[model samples]
Target: MKIRVEKPKRPAFLVPAVIIFLVIAAVFFAVHSFTETSVPLAYEITGFEGQVQIFDLSNHEWRDPRRGEEFKAGQKIRTGVDGILNLQVENSVRLRVKENSMLVNRECKLQKEVEIYRLGLDEGVIFGAMAKNLDRKIADNKAEFVVSTPQFDAKPFGALFRIQASEKADENRVGVLRGVVEVSRPGSLSGKGPMFNVRALEEAEVMEGRVQSPAKISAETWQELKEGYELLAKSAVMEAEQIDLAQKAGNFFEKAVFDHGTFFTPKVGYAGREFFKDPDSGEVYLETEYDVFPAGSFVGVYIKTRDFDISKYEGLIFDARRKGDEGFPDSFFIELKSKGSVLRKYSARGFLREWTPVDFKFNAQKPTLINEVVFVFTNERVGESKKGVLEFRNFTLTPKKDPVPVAPAIPVNVTDIVSPPEIQSTPVSEPSAAPSNQTSGQETFDEMVPQTISLG
Candidate 1:
């Protein structure tokens, strides 16, 4: 009885201290759970080829990544001269990094009501496609995909787009193929400069920290954008098929004009060129009208090849058709030139009003360097018509061996001309002064064709 009575009284602060400790632990657990839930899953590399290398933030080293490997935020990817990398994010967005590109994953977050992805492009081009209705899981859900560059940032709203950046030149270009892309300078995002909205089939450029006005995309750029979107669409369903198809398609686009060529029309008076997209089939093509002043004058368009090694390729392939019911010249010439001299000249005949596939196999003597590809139209072939419209698209170099069968190759005869003849018109110094006769509703030929060449 005496020992029980000797029990000491409990300290006043002990209970309160225990309660405070419990409250602090509860707060810490809640914050940690929130962070875990807010973090986004890693991006999955679906396919890659050539010298694609990845730099991991955790490892701090660049390593060759395999298909199906996961890439996390803070990681960087660099593609070599022939490299291509394909990635999938949250099953809703697909990205293709073109050759000689460097991309960095800055932020990726997927929450119950919102998904955010931000990427940094240091150099080269990247194609992106965001699936429509990505927020179908929740009515209030939203998604934001942004690509930041040295000069500008591109924000796409469930669209297909391409963003190119040149850190060396401090230039950025944004092109949209299917939807709208908001292009803004880095300072403009903070309400400094004006923002530009580039819509479907349009492009905008940013140089010297200024965003240029949006304009229609060129035929070559359109083809590049279309090919990239098609590749992503085809691979959306199956991962295994995606890897195989992406490699093959990547190789094809690398050598073709779609990746590193400049399509342009010479500053001549006889020809007017414009890019047209078919509303029905969604096919993009180059439409050219030739108005030969003299009965025998010639007109043409040129694609700068940038001296790509076509030794692995067998020949040239393209699609052409006559616009409307107008009769086209039976003789169409395709000349491969190196340095200003014609390397090989091939002539094709029998073009129909409907689209026809034309392929020309190189002769035994293939040039080691091909600087330009010219499509020449001579009024002499059409006799006294002296005027015609032609549509062309899908100009590519055929691989030496293709697994799938292609259209029957048309027989092309070699021409003896060593060089193209000079035009007989005075050069118009101003684009506005260009003849508006053929391009009434379209942009002037001089304005439509870019004077400076960009190798992809």
Candidate 2:
């Protein structure tokens, strides 16, 4: 200090420069913290009915989805006229897609603490619900579920809601059953249009990109909402049963010989077939009835196929049973055909009133391609009319069996063989007689018939 040492002078811009640097750093971090990070969400087909088709982005092809099939973002699902689809999303949301509808998974992302799901409904209806309890492990205010239509977007918060988009009518309808939904134009998320709050028991409609005021939900719509919930509940149970059935099926077959969902056309005399669900088991089966017809009549149903190959299979197996106490024939026929010409014929006989597994084994010299499968019920009883119902399910092709091992030949000398002495027979008391009404034995035959005759 005593020496005339000048204090190092600080730059006049030093403080401002430091402050500006801190400001830029803070700004950059704030923006970074607010930016959303993409999250991959799982979409699963919990259950489905009828002709539900999915356009998968992975392969860019439309195909039928089986239960428990997982889908990712950008996949589209469409339903046929009688189709219904159930979806479980991220273990937090459940959706029921109604018939004749098209839906797409548009976006899935994580923004800060919020998990987001955006679905697009190009047309038709969808019923959705958020997990209400802690069982789903989703915290409150942690998820955002939105369904967007061409006319509007429906944003539901912890709610059960239905959205129906009618492209032909140029309108979109939103019905809220629980919690609240915000109905707005398609770009309302970006503050582009007006929004309306649809509360429980209320509904609203959008026309020409304008959301109408919330109104009381109609009785018809209420019924529909109730049914949707019921269907969702049933689907959960159905999904569990389906998984169990699949596990039990194991690796026995490669493909179903006939699916319950397929359409069967009547090919011959006075026959009708319909899909029926068992009340006790909740399983669906095909119930085919042959009306009272004269002897020698052929009653059957046939499903069209396209180059279905069974060259690698050993046989066809199915479960079938007679449905009534009277008038059913003791036998039926299964035919694999190529363009209506018979390729193989199998006669299944002596099926009981209970479900029985029938297997028909065949050895083909070459690869067999079938164009159709026909189930024929014939009235072969002379001078008598026959009427009966039959139940069938689980028709599948069985895998080929492994070859048997051969034993080595053994040499024997004639002197080594000797005659043995016979013993006297012993008398024993017979067992008590069985019930008169009950038969002690039953037989079933699955004989392969010559394929010389065609049923076309």
Candidate 3:
């Protein structure tokens, strides 16, 4: 009877049911954990030129204070900040992302002989040097650097980007300093089909969720883009100009100086100097009437323009030459001034034995309408009293088409430190005992005229 009472009959399905329950519990835990703690893929942001950053999935947040923090790819980030994030690209280039920006690097693919990287720039600004991969067509041309944004795109090489502003604007805007760039929808019909190749440097505007044609952009914005390109492009020219300006003594306006019977002294100080080219000699160099030593040193020139409004020109362009050591100083520099204030500075670093064209902006990302120009030579290698040779030619300040009307010139009273009334072209014996009365005028020859050469 006791045995028959039977072990409480075990349910036939009890074991299997327990096992199933356990499995179900494990699955639930796994799913919950995944949903709670998983994150997007992170980008491998490193290169010879610099490092990169990724933003977390936070919209409309500022990252300025938290810069230098690592961000994973696919994690969304919005730039409410107002600064630039600098990253290295090529061994020789840098990439800078500005504030209020949204961008992502989708992929970095390295194939058998190709290294391809794709980036999605939603909004903001980017500045960097261009790299030439041995496997890509870029190595052949070098000038085609690619910049993509929601509204604009560009390719800037052998140059620098001072600023790129892409706020919620009426149009997509992209500009370059030196090299050429191509802009198009990578594979969109608006940019043509995937089979079609896009054109380089297309000026388009992004407005109301649509990218409009370049013709629709405002004159002011167009002027900004043009000015930006000029500023970036000027770096190379300034480098070459140093050599040309250093070699000559009297620069270009020797006739004007002699005709006016005014003695020109060397103004070798930092702020005030001029680079002039002979209208007839075709040789160019720096000129001043303040006897200061510029031997074996880098000096800059400042051109005081007539009281005229500068808003009309998008930028400045000129020609220059150098005949010194094959590769002397690596670069040259230029600066501008307005209303007794400094306007802009441009540096062109490279060689220029042949007459090369150079362009730079008076105001990048905007137009700074003023009438003064300054040329600067860096003291990169020169000691005291060293001589360098450089020549400038065919300088022109052409205004952008339909530029804002030139502003009327403002009369400025500049006080000079050196005032030698007479300049003797003939080398005076024993340097004429360091003249004491140093009172200089804007132009040593009170009547020096601005020089220009036709581009055509």
Candidate 4:
């Protein structure tokens, strides 16, 4: 009987095959778990009142609304009750999302040629420091960027600025502070929709889901908008004065005047105190002629930096033009004087009888706190040039903000960890929808978008 059983038929060897398959699957999963790379860039929440949930698609699910948390991309941050969030994106960009504001990433891509951030600004304000490269293009090419509101049924393009965008209904107002921006409205009048450069400021009212006719803002607001610009222009003249005074020990700061167009207004020289004039056509030109120092008499425009502490400022930037005379004395100079000494000086180059952007970084050493800045046009050369005219505009003094606190220190020792017995904040009451000057009926808004501003 034992011989007839044929050694029990060897059980088909199925057990070993099953064991081997399980072992291979386990090894593959173990390797895959260790290879995935997460984003290295971090984000910190600077300020927030209530518990806000920020959703990031890539990493994990949720982020604390509290201060000092890391943030990654595709994160949808929701404000709880009354929440104010200040998020620092990519280290250099600062984003402050106001309460009741909802921002969604429509599309964002970083490619070889350009980085595009298409964001939806729904019911709030988003302030950003555009990437330095974009700033460079704006300063160099005079290129203008566009921002639009999509949900509203008029035009896709909304308010555009250098790096600021705001959306509000009824009493909505958006403006450009330093760079060029184009506002495009839907219509056959393609060339229309105002083009703002430098200090060209405007605001439009949104009603009934449409941007309506612009309302007049007070001069106080206008002054506030133009304040930073005026100070910047004055600083240029102040720099020139410091150099001239140091060279000869005289009062040049007080006598310094903005020699070129300020805020794109053609500087009125050989005329009264007005630097430029605004015609109905909105064409600003600089038509000024003055005999600069053929041997360095210090001819330049001044900008006052009274309210701003530019000690940490990185540089002075602006656009310049040399027209009419092909070989005029366009050699320029920039100098920064601190206390009683000329701290820094930079000689101009690449003046090729065309409009050019000039960016000069200031030395990190203590600056003159530049109450005045000067842009010098020198005529001291072999040419028989006596008068030098160089038109300048779009001046900006950029300061580096204090390094933003990145991550909260993590405690290692058990004794160092103090569980902050979670203190809760008093919730603010949400206001009901009340009509004010800033809000208007939807019907009125619909009629306003297409209506042209009556010239009469």
Candidate 5:
């Protein structure tokens, strides 16, 4: 009787329809889960030093984060004098936050189609490294990665680069050690003005919404910045192996004239100074040409300025190179000047038509009045050829400051490249005015996908 009553109420269509709906729903969910990416919701703290503080988003509180603490999107972080912070992004990316600096995780949204990662530096410096072999072709790397500051924005495809925001000047400087970086001004996501590319050993300045062309930096000058950042973020064993304590650094570029000097070609032998950009790396260098060979005389260039009193500086730092020219002189000379020439000229080597970083230490006593600096090239050095193009940039007379610690060599290993769509940064629309300490030429940057400019 019970079985007959139950069977009488049952609908044949109802069971099948319900079962089909459940099957369809399960299939849809399984497909969606399979296509989703396994991205982390936050960056995990790896290491830290000094007095570091973080603003937690969940609790809305400022507190010290322990190792393995997570920094979510929009989390604010700052470091004190003794403060250094290290963080891991995914499995391949890393961040080193320097002392006396402030920054935030600007974006960490990984959607189905692509992911965008950004960090904002309000003041101070930060160094970042990313693996080169990232699978950019996959669906998640549309923006690649970027670091933004008060003055500019950097889209470093996969790079080792540093960002310094000067609290006083309200400007920002980016130093690239490896790979390629796209530099543009703030609010230029539309890439309003000319976009600049920076390569290894290059530095760019961003101020008042304009991007200075990239220029070469001395290895020591760069090391100071790079290693200093490393010291604050990582271990300080490498700092012990560096050069003398930094007393003071007089950046030749701080002045308007930039201590630009004359290339004395009194005779018919001529030389000219111009600025050129490397189309590939987007590096800027001052290009000077010695047109005709003149024996025992200089068709060279010099930079002398009374605007700066660099007496505190123990030596001068600059980078020089010769373009791919067999006609270029085999050697060049550097001179430092004051009321009287406290002359210790450095003989140029490594002029194999490539950029070379040189640190000219003072042989004599520090100059009494270092109001002038000079770089002289003459026909005396070359064996057969006297005419050539001299490429030079990064003229700084640094002072001796207290020794800063150095970081041990990081064991980051990267092999390969990343490729994404054309980012907001594009090539310069038109050639910028011929600027001091800049060079322009065609190089191949397009072929290298998802370039990384290493700060190290």
Candidate 6:
């Protein structure tokens, strides 16, 4: 019987099969653990400018919050006289607390398809920008916000809006740059409806629970406010070098130093739109696009400083580039126009798919103050030649001469604080660039002639 017994046959695949099964189980466990343990969404302090302080609810004391610091519900933040605090809530909404302002977080929820933020402004100004399509999502899913102040409570829905609260002035303001905001008194109706609806470019004031009629702001004022807040945000995030360059250029975009007032004769053009993209750096500086290939096609962003005299800046420096392949001309004219007399201009030959510098000096021969800056891309050639996108940016106004005294600082009233700061000529802002041995001056025709396109 012993001799007849055969050794038990081993299952050839048992060990390997068991090992594979264990590996699969381990992977599934890891994914399951990750899904089960969720980290709650929190408000992150993305950046700060000047002086900022935070009041912790648990600590019951104000402390300086670090960049990238996580703030939970019930924490409060304050910005001093020249301070700015930039925060991203639920990863969808950007909330900026301006100087002498305060913000307190209430609740934040990152739902399956949307995010919600509830907050309050005790006093001062708040700039809020919601990402595109996020406003529509609020109506589709649910109410996503509730912002409260002493005067009224609001639920803002849209891309850009602002709320300014002044306890001292007994004022509450709501301005919509892009979207709509539904507002009502504190502890008023729950679901029945909101009291007032403020639309894009519309503004309203609530004083002591009384909501005033909404009024549409002027296009110029709206543009100023938009630029003001954008500059604030940029300043909050900009590096040391970036701030230095921006300060030097007088911040044409942010400071609203210059504007494309009217085209002397524009065949084809677009304004305030993203029309140019850089080739190497890929940075879009200014929103100037022209596709005129005719005999005399010219367009420029004009500057109107009747409020002040800008006789100080004797020169201009900026970046310009033509868009397209080899068909378009690289020549353009940058004109510095003075209201009463002749205009000074520089003819430039430039490179397509790259940025070229247009640096010129304005003669003190004519009108005391420079009025407008215009770029004309004219092909005095035979006929309609080609199409291209002309872009401009990084403007540097040369050494400010003996500047006239700026008018007295405008009084900041309830309405005025909300208005954007207007740039006047007399009050020449000193560029914050470190004084180097190098200086900005007129780049003569002979200097850039070979590189410039032939217009004549």
Instruction: Give me the candidate number with maximum TM-score.
Output: 1
lDDT of candidate 5 over 1-456, digit per residue (tens): 455444466778999999999999999999988886746467889889899999987789989988998888889999999899988765356788888999899887665645667788898888877652332422244535777887788877545678788755545788765456789887565668678988655788876767899987653535444442232222233222111111111245454133343455444345555443444555555655553343466655555566454435655666777654225666665554555554334566556455666775442223344445554566666555544566666667667666689989967546645656776876678867765752221121212111111111
Give residue 418's lDDT in candidate 3 (0 to 100).
65
| Candidate 1 Cα lDDT to native | 0.66
TM-score of 4: 0.35
Name model 6 segments beyond 4 Å from true.
1-39, 111-114, 192-194, 218-224, 227-456
Q: What TM-score does structure 3 among the candidates reach?
A: 0.34
Q: Lowest-scoring 10 consecutive residues by lDDT in candidate 6?
A: 446-455
Which 10-residue span in candidate 1 carries the lowest summed lDDT? 447-456
Model 3 alpha-carbon miss at residue 155, Å: 4.5
Q: Which pairs clash in the backbone of model 2?
A: none
TM-score (C-alpha, index-matched) for candidate 6: 0.43
3 versus 5: better TM-score goes to: 5
Model 4 regions more than 4 Å off: 1-52, 56-62, 65-73, 80-83, 88-93, 136-173, 184-199, 212-216, 220-456
lDDT for predicted candidate 3 compared with the true structure: 0.43
Candidate number that wins on TM-score, 3 or 4: 4
Model 1 residue pairs with clashes: none
Candidate 1 lDDT, tens digit per residue, 249-270?
A: 2233345443112132232224
lDDT at residue 334 of model 1 (Cα atoms)? 69
RMSD per prediction, one decimal?
21.5, 17.3, 24.5, 30.8, 25.1, 23.4
What would you estimate as the lDDT of candidate 4? 0.43
lDDT of 5 at 356: 69
Q: Which candidate number maximizes lDDT?
A: 2
Candidate number that wins on TM-score, 5 or 6: 6
Question: Which 10-residue window of candidate 2 scores lowest in summed lDDT?
Answer: 439-448
lDDT preference between candidates 5 and 6, better one:
5
lDDT, model 5:
0.61
